[model samples]
Target chain A: MDFSQIIPSLPSLWDGMKLTLQLLLLAVAGGIALGTVLALARMSNSALLSGFAKAYVNYFRSIPLLLVITWFYLAVPMILNWITGEFVAVGAFTSCLVAFVMFEAAYYCEIVRAGIQSISKGQINAAYAVGMTYSQAMRLIILPQAFRKMTPLLLQQTIILFQDTSLVYAVGLIDFLNAARARGDIMGQSHEFLIFAGAVYFVISFGASSLVKRLQKRLAV
Target chain B: MNYNWDWNIFFKSTGIGSEIYLDWFVSGLGWTIAVALMAWIIALLLGSVLGVMRTLPGKVLPAIATAYVELFRNVPLLVQLFMWYFVVPDYLPEPLQIWFKQDLNPATSAYISVVVCLALFTAARVCEQVRTGIQALPRGQSAAALAVGFSIGQTYRHVLLPQAFRIIIPPLTSEFLNIFKNSSVASLIGLMELLAQTKQTAEFSANIFEAFTLATVIYFVLNMSLMTLMSLVEKKVRIPGMMGGAK
Candidate 1:
């Protein structure tokens, strides 16, 4: 009932929010870029390229995000040491960013693939008939249209990613949730701080989702 | 890397206990399945009701259902788990708070909170699926049922829901698979699920790669089996003239 503790904790919580936002924006950008390539590779005529992309998506999709985050957190340092022949300290932020981008690419790849598929086959044929190369057709004719169609879905996924950034706490990252918990521990009001954090998360996620819904409605027309 | 690989670490004794690392994995797998199955049952049951409410011919009921879905679906699963674990106990009345916080075993309490949190969170998603399924049904079906003297409840139970549920099998399969994957979050609250076991094994044996690799394989196998099983169910339940079953 006493939410008085949340006011004093706002400064630290704002720092945590910055980390969460940073992770969200970075992962969305990186994941979408990788996902677009994977979608192209998946739909390519070359069996090897398609198979690799398919396997990558399936592997990431089959497992939980928590395990992926943990794996990157634990294995990165060892992999770095093996490469350089000395121990290396890769921070939790870097590891989590790597994990989120890689894991989310699988999902984004599916979304992008669906988006690309939604474009009519005739459009690609027309692009090729005009002497455009495969890459050129995709880059100019197909992708622009697909990207427009996918904006709402991509934004919806970003909202999901924003919620998921809280999982970086697994690797001791000072995400908003972690920062709230830390402040809670020091202030002996863990429940109040947690409630505050949950309310904040709910507000952001719900508001973004509503915006995405409106955008979807407009796009449909 | 010049690091030595110990593939046999799963067979080695933990020294502090009689069990090997393999036993830890087996037990962890058991907990994972148990939590996922229990939570899935609750989510399905609760979500079905909420979904039906949203589709029913009333504003108040649908508004309530929408509110529930929006509230539960918006919050992250981890924060919800933390709230249930840390906050719910303090808000309970005096004797119940003591019972939850003190009288009950820590792991048991953690298990209960995780299951409840996950079920509520997932129920919101399931509600959407069910609502979509119900709404997707042709309006003629409801009208015909009503014209034939069927009550609203009877129409849903006999005519609407049966067809709607059949139509949504594919999406429902994905949701069912998600419950298993989402159950891994229980480890965050100290439930010692498969991921937690993997972390412990890595710490104990220092075979970080081996531990995670094995856990990943196990999860993959588990999901593959579920996918196969659900597909079989989907095939069996498919209505001949319906969406996926159409020739």
Candidate 2:
């Protein structure tokens, strides 16, 4: 509705989007890696490892992401200081990154677990027959297939992560949504700017989802 | 910053003997449950109707349902919360707007807006689960009901819906948990829900660790119990040899 406000504010919004993207990319990479380890741990023969991973995933999954962000933003620095005997300032970005990575890892762990489970047990055994260790077998044989099957799902979760990065606004981070809000308040067009931001969010998410749907279809074939 | 841990501060009064910090968490939990339950009802009712619409015999009905899902589902809950808070009040009729803005208690008004926002957002997701449930049913069941001279509504009520609902309980459970978790976003709009209370206590006591750790444990307990309850219900309602009800 207010094209005038949105045009000049594009740069500001882009800067915000860059931060959002940075959060997204970092979390996805770190989360998936952590998630894969958690998944493997959950599937491992050792009850201790499996139990720890299960607890981590369950605890993270049960709590709200917003709470996790708040907790980490506040508590991480405190814990760091307690350990080091000096006050440490963990910025909003790092705290949010840590929260997202940890939180999203649980969801990603489930996805990766399901993907790995879908692969036949025989395949892993066969890899073992060739004298590969568990990690080596998983890396050389299972992971490639699981990653392929899980790609669309991982992307879907990434879309969710993209949308969720907005919550960084809670801890005083200037993510895209907050940036738009800032610009909007400055220009006395908060309503229009918010509407525009919402539309932008809808388009990107909808577009990404459709792409996932397409990928699903292609993978099906 | 030498911070002394005060685990007992939750039970102690906040220097005035008016209320313990834990009282804030209790009330916040109460509001959280109220908001989540009310929103869950709306999600179930509206979601089922929209889901039914999506699966109906008409083209327009499905189209409308599709649009509703796309519009609501794609937007982040936080943005939607903001819209409901700031934008929707402006669009209301003048008297209603006044009631929302002036006549109603600030907390009550915020509660109402949050419930509506959360319900609508969740309904979109629930709609998908319900649709999948209905479509997952055997086509012959609906046809059989119709052949027995049952109206479409009767067919759905007696034949299709009962089974579809049973099939969807697991997903619906997750949706229920989601509503509880998502209720945290209401704090952004100044509703003193659980997360908000935890933040407030952390700030007041400087025992951020104890406060959030306690909140996390409570959330875990709530969610785990819900999961256990739903699993029991699923087991009870499980129609043997059915798609989702299989043990």
Candidate 3:
């Protein structure tokens, strides 16, 4: 009901928003880079490569992101100790970053695979006829076209990623939602701060998705 | 690190009320299934109505429906859950507020908030699926129903919805599976769902790998079995020569 509490809390909430944007950007970059490799591996002729890629995608897709975040949170320090023979402390942000990137890569791999498959096979053949090596053909010809076709979908996934970054709260990360709730706990206006946070999330995600829709429409032609 | 790998932790007691770790997982599974199944019913029903509303022959109703979908779809489910849990109770009337905050069991309150939040969030997605299913039908089907003197309502009831629901079985099945996964979010608010139970077990026993691995396998088997069951339903109801039903 009361909206006045939100103004005083904007500073903390902005810090939270920055952290969210950081996770979103890093995850998108890492996920797409890893996903591109997985997609290529899945599409390659070797059965072992494709089989590994398939299993990776299927396993991640079947589980929830919250579980993945929790798993990484618990596993990273132990895995680090195994490598270094000493216990290492990893921050919540770092663990969540690894979790998001790994989890999102599986989804992006499927999207990128579909995008690559949409390109005509003759294009790859023509590249071969021109004496281009497979990597050269993929990097120069196939991937460029696939990226263009996949842009709208990739952006849409990024919007979803933006929303999902809020899950970092599971590990006690000071993301946007957590920041808002913290401020609310202090101000005794928990309701107002939460409603305000919800609105801010709505505006950003809804606006981004609308832009994606427009881009999808333009790309279709 | 030479970590202890005790596969028998599930059989050990938690030192409180004589309950074993396996009991935690079983109860957690029960809560997960209860929350997901209850929410799915609400989502399916409300989503279908909103889907039909968006396609109706009016500007206001469609706009309202579109706004509902966009509002629910864009916000993160966790934020929505927080709002429902921590905020919504305060806005209720005094007696209801007292009942929600003071009279109701904390676990029950958390469960109600999570179920409502998940249902609304998933309903937005289901609305789109239903809308697409309805729109994918050839226009002639609806027009022909009207031509035969069927009202719009009757046409939807008798002709359109049955077909639309049939075509969307595959996508709807995915949504159904997603509800189970999304139900895990309930844990963040202190509901002892599967993920929460897994975390508790890991911390209590210090067998992190075994705990998470078991939860992961449970989720995988649950999803795979649901997919198999839905595919069987998809086959049983497939209309010959229909778009998705075609081999």
Candidate 4:
């Protein structure tokens, strides 16, 4: 209930929020990029490419994000060491980011696939009739429409990604939640700090989701 | 850099056949299922009520339901779990607080907190799904029930809910699977669930890959089976020439 304790700790919390935002933005960007490719692969004619993408999406989607973060946290350094001839240190931040990107990509792939499939096949046939190559048709025609149709779902998923950034605490990454917990522990006002942090998360996510709803309405028109 | 891999550690007893690392995993799996099942009961019951309230013919109830969904759905489960585990107990009456802190078993208390936290968190999502399912029903469905002398409650109970449940099987299945995955967050509050047990085994044996790989495979199996089971249920309950059926 007391805002006074949390006010004095805003500076440290902001530092954690920056890392949290960094992870969220980077993961979302990487996830969407990879997800688009995976979606296309899933739709492709080749068995091997589609099979690999399906397996990747299924394996990632089936597990807990916490476990994925832990796995990458523990395994990435070893993988890096094997790749290079030196002992490489993948920090918790990097490992967490990698895990988020990899894990979220699976969900995003499904969204992107649904978006692409929503576009009428006649449009693609028309593009081919106009002497457009497959890649050109997809780039200039299909992807643009698919991306537009999927913007709201994409934003909704981003809201989910924002909430899940708190899971980085599992790997000892001091995200916004952990930062608040640390300040609370120091001040013996764990309740107040936690309540404040929860409110902050609510406001941001609720705001973002409403924006998505608005965008969805506008797109409907 | 001596990274030892001991896959056999899973079979080795902790001490004189008391238990093995694999036993920890099995117990953890049991707790995970128990938590998920209990939370699922809370979610279905509460979510249905909230969903009905949102669709009712009043402004106040729907507003309250909307607020509840927005509040619970927006916050991360980890933060909510922390609040329930660490903060909620403080708000209890002095006698109850004393009993909670002094008399109750710590593990049982942790388990209850996790189940409650996860249930409320997921109930918000289920509320949305239920709302959508109800809204998707044809107006004539309810109108016919009213014409047949059914009250509004009877209309919803007999005419709407059955069809809504049928319509929402797929999403509900996904939500059910999600709760199972989300149960992993309970490990943060020191519940020795599957993920926590995997972490324990990994740290103890220093074979992180072996331990986590086993955990991942177990999770994958659980999720895939749920997916298959739900799909079968979907097929069984699917309205003829609707939803999943080809016209």
Candidate 5:
């Protein structure tokens, strides 16, 4: 409805764009790695590691992202203070990264577990017959194939992570939504700017979705 | 800066020093479940009807279905909440707000807001569900209803909706849980639900960890229970020979 107002705001949007990319990449990289470990832990022979993974995934997955961000933002500082005599140099970027990584870990764990579960027992038997250890076989043979197959899902997860990065605003991060709100405050127009912000989010999401689509189709041969 | 652990303060705050709203927390869980149940019913009935509408012969009906889905699904829930609680009342004449203020409990406003938001959002997904169910129904069932002199409405009421609901049970369960989580957002507009109680307890105790740990544990139990109950229901709904509604 207000095309004229939204058009000029692209430069300001670039700042948000950079922040979004930074948060998305950092969290997805870190989160996916943690998630892989958690998935393996959950599936491990050791009951302790498996139980710990189960609790972590169950706890993180069940809570709303907003509440998680709030708790981490507040609790981290106090926990730090309790540990040390004084405050640490932890910052907003660090805060956002910690919360997103933990939350996304739960989802990625599920996805990675699904990938692992899909691998046939026959393949593992074959590896075992060749005298390969479980860890060696998983790392050398099974995981590489699974990771390749799980790429589209990983991409989709990245998009969701990008969308969820906006929740960092609850913790006072100047992410895209926060920036848009800042502009809206100066311009005195909340609805239009909110729509603009939503559109920006949609663009990032849709782009990733389409890329995933193409990848899925390409892999179908 | 590595520091010493203060288990003393943590335990003192979480335990004896301040009151946690256990009664409020339990009642809040009840209220959350209640709102989710009522909203799920509304979503099921409304969504099924609209879903049926999208499949009916009229071009206009499908368009109406699309419009409903798009409008409700596109906006953020927070904006929708603000509009319902803050904007809608102002549009009504001052006398109406005065009447509502006098007569309706503040909690009713919160409930009404959750229902409207939940129904509107869930209906979109429900419409998709019903449409899939209808399309999946065997071709002769509707014809049999028609040949028996059952009106279109009668056909849907007896023959169609039941079958459709059965087909969509699994997805519908998740939708119920989805609405349950979404209800926590109602605390934003002062609904004192679980999360609201969490915030209130946090502020009162000055120990955020104690308050939030309690909240997280409660949420974990409630949600895990929901998953358990839903699986039981799913098992019960399985018509003995027909597993996962296979043809």
Candidate 6:
């Protein structure tokens, strides 16, 4: 509502954006790696590995992100301190990163599971016929193909993750959405806060959507 | 082997009985389920109408639909709720302002605002999914229905929605989970949902681990149960002929 005041507070907004970007990058990168492992484990032929992976994803996936973040940032450290020397509690950004990784990994595991499961089973057999080890067959044949189909799913998940960075605000991280709130507080203008923050989210999501379309085009799908 | 896990302290702070921490945890779980159920119902009803309208032939309607989706879909529900709770009230008429100030409780208003914001936001996603499901049906079914002189309403009722819902059930369940998870954001505005309760409990008991752990478990149980129910619904709605279309 107060343009004059908000314009001057852009630097604070930028700070929030920095936090948002770092959190997203960490969560997405870590989540994708952790998720891939979780996915493979879930899909593993070994019952123990599959059950472990399934439990990991199921437990994390079922919980809300805020609850998880609060737990890690608050509880885990307290428990650690109770036993021994002071624990290295993660900063707000890192706390969200860890929680989002666990949460997003659960989802990514499923996405990867769907993609991996959807691949024709006989492709592995065909790869095996060529004297490929199971690992070799998976690495060379099944996954590359699965990766193609996962493009859209991956894009969708990324967008959802981006939006979820907003939740990190509750943990006291000045994310993009949080920046808007700060702006509102400083300027006493909620409209400016929401409008700018909403625009930031929209840009990120729309950008991801376009990237997906580009990937589809390049893949000629 | 030096890791001494003190189960007793955690048990005392977090376990059952007149423990304030445990009360917060239980109440938090109750709030999460309450808001999710309330928001899901509103979204489903509103979204179904919009979804049905999307398929109807009208230039004006599609634009309206597009605008509706774009407005809600593009923004974070948190921001929407924030605006609804904080900014929108100021713009209301004078009597409405007095009513909001004197008659309405901020806490209840916050929940109602959250319900409205979450419902509209989620309804956009549901509308798209439903519309996709409905449209993905082979063109022939609707064509055949029309050939038999089935009215548009009749065709939608008898021929389209039933099959579309069958195909959309799996994704629909996922949306249900997503919305349920999202409702936690209402905590920011002092809606004492699960997440907020965790914060309050942790502050009071200084047992953040147990308090939040309980909330997390409750969320896990709630979502898992919801997922199971949804998948069951998915199975029940599995029409044999609709297999080819669903994702």
- What order do candidates take by DockQ, descending? 3, 1, 4, 2, 6, 5
Model 6, range A1-221, lDDT digits (tens) per residue? 55666677888888888877787888888888888889899888899999999889878877777778777776555555666667666566666677788889988888888988889989988999999997898789988898788978887888878777787777777787877787787677767668777877887777777787788788773
Candidate 5 residues B133-163, lDDT tens each?
Answer: 8888988999999999999999989998777
The per-residue C-alpha lDDT of model 2 at residue B1 equals: 63
List, in order, the clash count of every candidate structure. Answer: 0, 0, 0, 0, 4, 1
In terms of DockQ, the best-performing candidate is 3
Residue B232 deviation, candidate 3, in Å? 1.2
Write down the DockQ of candidate 3: 0.88
> Compared with the true structure, what per-residue lDDT tens digits does model 4 show for residues B115-138?
999899989989999999999999
TM-scores, in order shown? 0.98, 0.97, 0.98, 0.97, 0.79, 0.88
Docking class of 6: medium
Mind giving the per-residue lDDT tens digits that candidate 1 earns over B1-247?
7666998999999776699999999999999999999999999999999999999986999999999999998898999999888888888999999999899998889889999998998898889999999999989999999999999999999999999888787898888888899888888889999999999999988899999999999999998999999889988888787785856
DockQ (C-alpha based) per candidate is 0.86, 0.75, 0.88, 0.77, 0.26, 0.51
| CAPRI classification of candidate 1 | high
lDDT for residue A175 in candidate 3, whole number 0-100: 95
Clashes of 1: 0
DockQ of model 1, rounded to 2 decimals: 0.86
Tens-digit lDDT track of model 2 for B199-237: 999998888888988898888888998899999998888
Which residue runs does candidate 6 get wrong by more than 4 Å? A79-84, A217-220, B1-22, B231-247
Model 5's CAPRI class is acceptable
lDDT of 4 at B242: 74
Each model's lDDT? 0.92, 0.92, 0.93, 0.92, 0.76, 0.79
What C-alpha root-mean-square deviation, in Å, does candidate 1 show against the real structure? Answer: 1.1
| Clash list (residue pairs), candidate 5 | A83-B3, A83-B4, A84-B2, A84-B3
Tens digits of lDDT, candidate 3, B183-213: 9999999999999999999999899998898
- Scored by Cα lDDT, where does model 4 land? 0.92
lDDT per residue for candidate 2 within A1-96, as digits (tens), equals 465888999999999989999999999999999999999999999999999999998889999999999999998887788898987788989989
Model 2 residue B128 distance off true place after TM-score fit, in angstroms: 0.5
CAPRI accuracy category, model 3 = high
